[model samples]
Target: MGQASFACDPAQTRGRRVAEEESAFRSCFQRDRDRIIHSSAFRRLKHKTQVFVEHEGDFYRTRLTHSIEVAQVARTISGALGLNTDLTEAVALAHDLGHTPFGHTGEDALNALMQPYGGFDHNAQTVRIVTELEKHYADFDGLNLTWDTLEGIAKHNGPVGDPVPYALAAYNALHDLELHSHAGAEAQVAALSDDVAYTNHDLHDGLRAGLFTEDQIAALPIIGAAYGEVDARYPGLEPYRRRHEALRRVFGAMVADLIDTSRDALAGSGCAGAQAIRDLGRPVIAFSDRLRGDLKEIRAFLFQRMYRAPSVMAQREKVTKVVEDLFPLYMSDPGLLPGRWQRDVAQAATDAALARFVADYIAGMTDRFALQEHARLTGTHVLGDLT
Candidate 1:
């Protein structure tokens, strides 16, 4: 199928941060996707948590699996909307690169610790990872990704404005990402696709973890309707099959709604080019208002039942202390950092700069790594001795 006139055309990308020869066969966006997949930051996501601590159990979703699911959803939505699937996949895969090890809990701890050091924002950290942290290239420090990919990741939620995260603002000064404007249509599709993947998977993971039961979820809005339909068709189905069948239907409904709503928005906007979609001042990709309302109820239920459950909170308290203790220790003596990271610490000229470097070192750790390092330094195990 032909692309929409407003789709992000790979041939027309704004080019990489450090200019280089274009690929012989692959498109710019495809190269960005490949680079992200091969990055160490992306690999670390394997041991990063989505909801539960990484060591809690292998059954729960980790950031790596979550990113793959987001990419799958984004590609489907982008293909349906005639957007650039490669660019959408690139954004989806790289969106969570800067997330700390213990999920949002680790991020919250780091953000609080760094409050005096310009604070921690994962979106900004992602920009830093692509633009400054990764050092694989011969000529450049970070992966020299195209402007489109960078912008999409930076503004994954929306446009950046005043009070921007220090990392993002610093990079933006050198190479402007049009921080005040919306990202391309492909990026918008990727952003909404993240919402869809996380919302549905959290429910699935929650059920699998026994935080809530199928019967309880069967009373929620969209989920309830899905379970009702499944029961009517496959009466007295096996519990495992019934749960999978119902959740898959809920997932399908969300995807279909997103595609339909996006198509309507695109047709009504009369955008003639990719830039026109960005200039429209509102996202063209989104869930319908009714679905959005239903999702809110589902999220509220998850928040109370799964995220805030006593078991999870206990793990959260442990991991929070791991981050809290590690930051101060590394800051007080940069020599404590591993050999590779110590080089950067040695080159720091000011206390604040040193703190930032330490923050970056801590932020890049996997959940297991953080706990291990904390135990090594303090002789106190956060998650107990690893088997």
Candidate 2:
């Protein structure tokens, strides 16, 4: 039940960028988690996209709900693997802080627009937000998170090979995140938790959106078996209940495989400390090959049936246009920007610097706010009769 030696211990934390007195009642990771939960960016996630835009439906997963689910999954995985749950939870919660309003669609659009500049990456934007953009504290421009949390956020997916995104690269120049190595145990757990949460909920959202039927997904691998098991247990269960039961089981299957496979790997790997886990140059947390294959099938099905479906594609185009419209509009006329943004706009040395600031403003917008701004500026309705 106790934390493993390979878990990151907050007491020996590498400390924040701007050193401060440690909290008497909280670990550094706990403070990081608390700061993230209370940040302005975190509050804006309620209107950001997951699979669908925020206004698509009340029941569909928003970025905020998806983050909470990922944090929940991370804690469960971290607890079972004897990793630091608080650190895992913090990384999980902060993982999507840089996502744009309309989700990947908006990001894709913004990236294309900024291609002449240094390109936009959600991961790099996340580093920018925590280390620079967030400006609540009097002492620092950004949240002065512990070195461990920043490292986890910088490369939770793995080593940041050549050509790292601009924001991450810039920050690493100031405070190195050890970009060539894997993140520590808790971060690895958070990354896998993101996979587990999104894969499961995308199915749930697809079903609820009526993009695909439960019977159709019942043909998929792990999901079909889950559906079959539910039918055997309760023959006449209602439709929604049946769907929920089967999907919950599918979720359990992913979490369990990750825990079981990862625990075996950890127990055998001889990683005596968190650094050893990072130094191993491979993922210590992962689903078994069978589950991975099953998940592949599920993901392919969802890609074809939900993500690229006609209705979703229509919505994607609309939001993409909104971002496309907003970016150049702001660039051509920084005068249109609010008074607070004007000082920064005036300070921009070059078009590239100005573009980065514009991207930052656009990236911070929520879906509804983006829509409102697009309407306000362009005087054109982007989301037309979107469900």
Candidate 3:
């Protein structure tokens, strides 16, 4: 299929923060994707948590695996809808770059701790990572990605306004991302792909962890229908195989629905260009109302069964304390930070600035590194056997 009328055209990208010569072999979006893949922040994701902690199990998803899955799903959907697959893949791969060590639990703890210091938002942190954190470039502080790539990453979730996170606001002051308007259709597709990947994989993970059984999941709406079909087609299939078959069906259904729904929305909107889709003030990529309702039911089940289950909650408490302890300790004694980070700490003129630097340092840590650092500092193991 040809590129969609509303697909982001690489030739027309808004360009990078620090101007540089164009690549001889790669399009702007491809260059952005390559840069993200090679970034130090991206490498740290292997040790970051998705739902379960990194040490919980070898089979459980880590941020690195989850991002790869999201990229695969996004590429499939973007290809089906004739969207810009390169841009969509870039957004999907980079979306969670700023997620804390212990999944959402660590993020919540950090946000609570940073409430007075402008608060923590992963999306904003992601913006900060690409704009200022990755320091390999001699010319620029961050990756110096194209404006289109940056806009997609920053606004992939939708329009952001009022009380913007400090990192994003500061960057926007220098290079505006048009925070009040929607991102391109490719970015919208990447955002939805994240939901698709996490929902399906979490269900698989929950079942694998034995927090919830196939019988329990079979009671949900769309997933139930999928299980029913699986059982009917392959009676007496092994339990593990049965679960895989049912969940794969659920995943396929979601991706298919998203493609069809997005195609219809694009057709109805008459968006002849990528910017027109953004100016429409609504996402052109989304699941249908029926699938959205079904997903809501599934999310509720996951929230109650897997996320809130006692074992997971216990782990959350442990990691929360690790972040909570590390933040104030570093704030008071910035000398504890690594030598490079200590230089920034020394440069911090005010307590608030020092606190933010500490936040950045802690946020960048992997789960095991955070635990090790906490143990080193406090002379106690926070994670116990999990470490």
Candidate 1 segments whose C-alpha is farther than 4 A from its true place: none
What is the TM-score (0 to 1) of candidate 3?
A: 0.98
Candidate 2 C-alpha error for residue 18, in Å = 0.3
- Write the residue-wise lDDT of candidate 2 on 28-132 in tens digits: 999999999999999999989876877767888889999999999999999999999999999999999999988999999999998999999999999999998
Please list the residue runs of candidate 2 whose C-alpha ends up more than 4 Å from where it truly belongs after superposition.
Answer: 385-387
- CA-only RMSD, every prediction: 0.9, 1.3, 1.0
User: For candidate 1, lDDT tens digit of each residue in 73-178?
Assistant: 9999999989999999999999999999899999999999999889998989999999989999899998999999998998868888789999999999999998
Error of 2 at 375 (Å): 0.9
Going through the candidates in order, what is the number of backbone clashes in each? 0, 0, 0
lDDT of 3 by residue, 1-387 (tens): 889888999988999989999999999899999999999999999999888987778899999999999999999999999989999999999999999899999999999998888999999999999999899999999999999989999999999989888889999999999999999998998999999999999998998899998889899988889999999999999988988999999999999999999999999999899889989988899899999999999999999999999999998998899999999899888888889887778889998788789888988999889999988889888767434
The 0-to-1 C-alpha lDDT of every candidate, in the order given, reads 0.91, 0.92, 0.92
Evaluated against the true structure, the overall lDDT of model 1 is 0.91
Model 2 reaches what TM-score against the true structure? 0.98
Q: Report the error of model 1 at residue 55, Å.
A: 1.1
lDDT of 1 at 309: 95
